[model samples]
Target: MGIHWKIKSFEALSTHELYDIMKLRSTIFVVEQNCVYLDLDGKDKVALHLYGEFEGKIVAYSRLFKPGISFENASIGRVVVDANYRERKWGHDLMREAIAGIKTHFGESKITIGAQLYLKKFYESHGFVQTSEMYLEDDIPHIEMKRESC
Candidate 1:
């Protein structure tokens, strides 16, 4: 089977959809990573949510932000693919959709992301260039990356 992609605003998300999103995020960013930080940073209300559903469950997801929210340029954050689904290369698919979503929804040419240091090469493959030195975000080593409009 193939994955289905969907993009929606916070207000447009159904309660079940929102719950699944939060569950997936917590499963990855919290339990899997062992990170202890505030997952609900109060940004969801304004950012766009992009997710990939497989077998009726969200297996991949990301959040899109317009300029001036998380960075000076449009941004993509919370990029994730379910643990069981990593082998399918859905991370790349999620990013492709995210970049397009930013351009289509925000009319922005450039995008920035605070990516985990270990995944620098993965994000670079999508044209995101490292823009900042590594820093600690949520106790994880991270660096800022930027992808300019083509």
Candidate 2:
């Protein structure tokens, strides 16, 4: 199966779309990860939401921020792939579009991300390089990474 991609601002999100995004986030980040951090960090109001849907259900998601929004540089956050569909590898597609969205919409090639430690190589394959030491966020180890351009 292939993913149908959508990118929109918080205000542009329909109630249903927003619900699906939140549900999926909670499912993966909260329940599955067994973490209790606040998912709504007030950044969504300023970020662009990117999600992939299959058969009317959202299975992957991420939020994109312009430079100076999430970090000193444009960033990608809240990356998640539905546990049920991980074997399908839609996470890669979600990331490829998110990177392209930054260039196409924000005219930025340099991007930053606070990625979970376990996915360091996954992010590396997409051109992100670790730039900070590992630290815990909501009890999950994470590291800062940057993609200089392209």
Candidate 3:
């Protein structure tokens, strides 16, 4: 089956949708990555959520932030694709949808993200250029990247 995409603000998310989102995030960011940091950082209330569903499950997910939330420009973060679906290259699809979501929802062309160091090329393919020196977040090497409005 093909992926189904959805974008919703915090209030628009149904209880089940919210649960699945948090569960997917925890599965990847906390358990899979072995990173222990607060996932609920009080940002969701103001951010836009983008997710892709497959077979009634959330297989891809990301969050979009308006300017001044995570960066001076609009931003995309919490990018994740279900481990079961990663081999299918849904990460790229997720990003493409996320870029569009940022442009459509926020009407902002410039987007910034603090991406994991290893995935620099993945983000680069989406037009993100490294804007800051490598740094560590949650003990994971990360770099700030930016994509100007196109």
Candidate 4:
């Protein structure tokens, strides 16, 4: 068996599931990145959570947003793969699922994201184009990217 994918809204997430999501986000976004920002931005309530689970642990995760929620276009954020799982192609898998989920749930093909500068090419491979200059967010360099439906 391989990783399992799940897409759920805030209201549909169980307490443990929510906790696991938060834990993974913090592990990467806060500790690994060493950037301190409000992780709970009060937007998770409206976004769709996409994650991959393996062996009972959340390994890869991203959040999908409908238009007008996080950005004017459909968006995917908080993309992460457990550091140990990076070699397994889970990151690509997560983004593929996220793009599909965005289309499935929002009926939109235009998607945007605030991606870490280091991962620009990774996103570009998935059809995202850099739309903004390099900028600092919580002391880490980031770039805004957009993907339009082909």
Shift in Å, residue 97, candidate 1: 0.1
lDDT of 1: 0.96
Compose the digit string of candidate 2's lDDT tens values, residues 32-138.
99999899888988989999999989999999999998789999999999999999988889899999999988999999999999999999999999999999988
Report, for every candidate in turn, its global Cα lDDT versus the true structure.
0.96, 0.94, 0.95, 0.94
What's model 3's lDDT at 50? 96
Superposed model 4: Cα runs more than 4 Å off: none
Order the candidate numbers by TM-score, best to worst. 1, 3, 2, 4
Model 1: residue 7 alpha-carbon error in angstroms: 0.2
Clashing pairs in 4: none
Pairs with steric clashes in candidate 2: none
Error of 4 at 14 (Å): 0.5
CA lDDT, candidate 4, residue 69: 83
Native-to-model Cα distance after best TM-score fit, residue 37 in candidate 1, in Å = 0.6
**lDDT, candidate 3, 117-146, per-residue tens:** 999999999999999999999999999999
List the pairs of residues colliding in candidate 3: none
